[model samples]
Target: MDQEQIPGGPEGTGRRRFLALATGTATAAGLGSVAGCASGGDGTSGATLKGKGAGKGSTPEPGPGGFDVKAENARPGNADWRVTKAGPARAIEGFADRVSVLPGESFGLHVSTTAPRFTVSAYRMGWYGGARARLVWRSEALPGVRQPEPAVESGTRMVRTRWPRTATVDTKGWPEGCYLLRLDAQGGEGQRFVPVTVRSAAAAGRTVMVNAVATWQAYNRWGGYGSYDGPSGGYASRSLSVTFDRPYDYDDGAGLFLVYEAPLIALAERLGIPLAYATTTDVARERRLLEGAAAVLSPGHDEYWSPEQRAHVTAARDAGSNIAILGANCCFRRIRLEPSELGPDRTVVCYKSSYEQDPGFKRGHPATVDFRSAPGADPESSLLGVIYDGYPVDAPYVVTNPGHWLFEGTGVKAGDGFAHLVGVEYDKVSTGFPTPRPIEILAHSPVVCEGRPSHQDTAYYTVPSGAGVFATGTMRWVEALDATGDGRSGANHGLDARAGALTTRVTENLLRAFAAGPAGKTHPAQDNVNAVYGGS
Candidate 1:
């Protein structure tokens, strides 16, 4: 894709004129300072920031029960200590039995190491009185053993580590929230992490936040085989099926959680929104988890999904549970789950190839390929109001419908562009797909993708069931929350202070409104796609 065609690109004079109009309108409106911007050193306005400890210039203080802040220097982008770096390179590394579990349930850990022993610590992530995470528990140095990577099987290309359990942490008293289990080998060689969420089954009247674990496992290359084969080989070597029996090879075992999911989780907690947590697998196996929820949140980069999981979420929305997709490229791949040698429903199978290559394809099942492709033909746009477009381009997020409630504050106006917010991958409401009628395309930023001129869209749509659906239409939505570009989010994506503030305000508005209940019941989306673009 040519960079010159993107919004705010060097060759786009129209965008410059629109920017002038937007800036002028905002200045004339006399929008005051967004609340809470200065108070919380974290850069988010209206929310009290916590967890700024010693590493970031704040005083080192013990958390509840005198638990030491072991990861004092742990911040974004520091690869070594950041909760997201992948590991086991001359260091002890591990992963959890499950991405999430209910309180009072037992959670297991699988550790791999070159050292004889290692210590484990649990930090509950939240806005805890200026500390981002509070030390909850720690384990003594325990015996460890390194395990060999599992060999790839024939047709499926599935890899299973079959590593034995290293530790089991009882979750009897742990609060329902995001937690990072940190592992450090003896001799201080290095450290890594495994992210878990202690979920709540009783989600009545609360928003349900789902961590995209399936996508993480799909991309995990712990056994040298992810969905996408690395430089070592091509599609022939890629794993058609991946098991959760091994540690993640990226983001310190957190996979894509830090980049795509963590920021949104932190922000939701900071706002004290009534919330519960779960994994994509959890929802797939148990539909009842979202039965009475007020809303469901799908994080950034939720690409792979099973039919059962899709049905559950769609049914929940039909029952009036609002859904907010905070990123693009969501539900793009159709996968099927099967019981692993370790446990049930631990294997995700997606053969991104020809129908003949997929065993299930011949059975008249949804082809294990892109959701919008082939026999299934179930376009995500029908559910998300936008479909996955092209990739590898970065463009400004230009607001076209700033008057919508989602952009209530922060002084945004028509044609206001948040630089570099549209990136990596994006979505659009296209007539070629099954788009929901009466959808509102909020941001219409033009960019060139695969040498073709196209526009990315952030959209909102309402259904008769009183469910409100929203899509950010960009993969960088969550990363923009790191207003300071501190690398906590891994890559900065060129986001600046203005972009952060604008995104934060817009996110706050979305969450607050959705938390009230089904937003369609109160503020139904008015179809503006035709009005804005002059066509259906």
Candidate 2:
């Protein structure tokens, strides 16, 4: 392979024709038109967005070995608001004091609502005896509690919601896995959820999967303010900081966990893979949690990262723990964790608009902005093998390097496009940033982003410490795990049956390999960057 001979290169007629045909067919089927190319662009072809397949509404039957395809129970209302309406309604919604806990530890709940009474139920998520989850415990109807109204700080535009503790749950015998606490108001006001992870004290020799709770809280807009939304409900009124004390306002408070994190957990448990669970805050507070783990799996839309969290995970990789980043736009935003009025590590501070607003901006620290931005200047590509490029795209995920081990048993070939698997946000390798050398470019799909033509890449790279890093370079990777195509709005990205099958196969391959000690020790990635791009 040579630079000009690459799949989407100018000299590759087959790929060009394939893309053209795929775009035309997609457009004819009522999907959106392909994005236009800018002049002097990289050698990649543009693709039209495709509609969700007609099989979107069909339920997937169990696969071989009795593997269940349904894991929607992890989310509140089982991914259907109608089901939530049919059940007991509740006005109160709350979240746990801590995003995660260990066995033998007690965690508190912070509730908010006008109802006078409510109850909590704990459901441990897994592939339990053909059912996706099992109810472990239920509380007697408890008095409903409300927190003080959120007050805006005068100077920073931060909303501090100092909620009083309502109830406490003891995890004396809770199993080590993902658990969702369902809050129901006896007054029929509706339902909501608080996600909790029971950390395994015995995480040695297991693969540790991290749930991106920090990112979820960062985007949470419960108190009329989020890191993305300002006081006036506009982007310009965005808050510089967000607190975790507030309940998520979307999807009955399940937030992004169900679509992005639960599918991977369900799939891992179904395969009976030895697994441990933790949150970004947990890793930041205690680095020892990652010790002796075979790998750390970061799944789905993990955009926000703290300095300590990055350092801990980087140290783990250097000590020979494999790293698998299963989504794009990962480690893109650099943020700092601070103790809120409630407790430690409860506030996420990121001044995305102006670095001057950051307390450490003038101290020569990594600015509270996108990692690749100035003053910080630490491109995530060095760690992720690819950097965030652009957004608002929905194109096919074309396989460029089918010979890689990650594609084993997928039956994909060069130029083969998995319908609607790449979308909304994607990443790519560029010489403009500090990328690891000798990296392999796997999926190089051309798509338009904000009117500029570019390419998205799935990359794999290995380090001398016998640690391997893999990135999917697309936000839709984990959402596609729901072969049934039932996902939260704005998260599913129109994935269908074919996309689900392809993503599941590749994910299984990645998990199995990473679970077995250091992946680079036995299956080192063969770098083809020079051969493909003619770079040094």
Best candidate (score: TM-score): 1
Candidate 1 segments whose C-alpha is farther than 4 A from its true place: 1-90, 362-365, 485-490
| Number of the top-ranking candidate, with lDDT as the measure | 1
Q: lDDT tens string, model 2, 50-135?
A: 21211122212323212122332222222221116313323677777677788547676777667776666666666544355655
Candidate 2 runs further than 4 Å off: 1-83, 86-90, 360-365, 485-491, 534-536
Model 2 poorest ten-residue lDDT run: 1-10
**RMSD, each candidate, Å?**
15.0, 17.0
Candidate 1: tens digits of C-alpha lDDT, residues 1-536: 00011011011121121111111001111111111211112211111111111222222233331212222223221122344333347367777766677765666677778877666666666555335565555554566677555677878777776665655555544456677878877776668878888776756678888988888887787767777763365655677788887777766666787777777877876776677778888899897878878889998779889988999999998999899999888998889887876567788888766556776667776778778877767888888989988766678889998788888888888898877888878898887788877788889999898688989999999998898999999888887886666333334766787778877888999988888888998888888887767787
Model 2 per-residue lDDT at 3: 8
Count residue pairs with overlapping backbones in model 2: 8
Worst lDDT run of 10 residues, candidate 1, spans 1-10
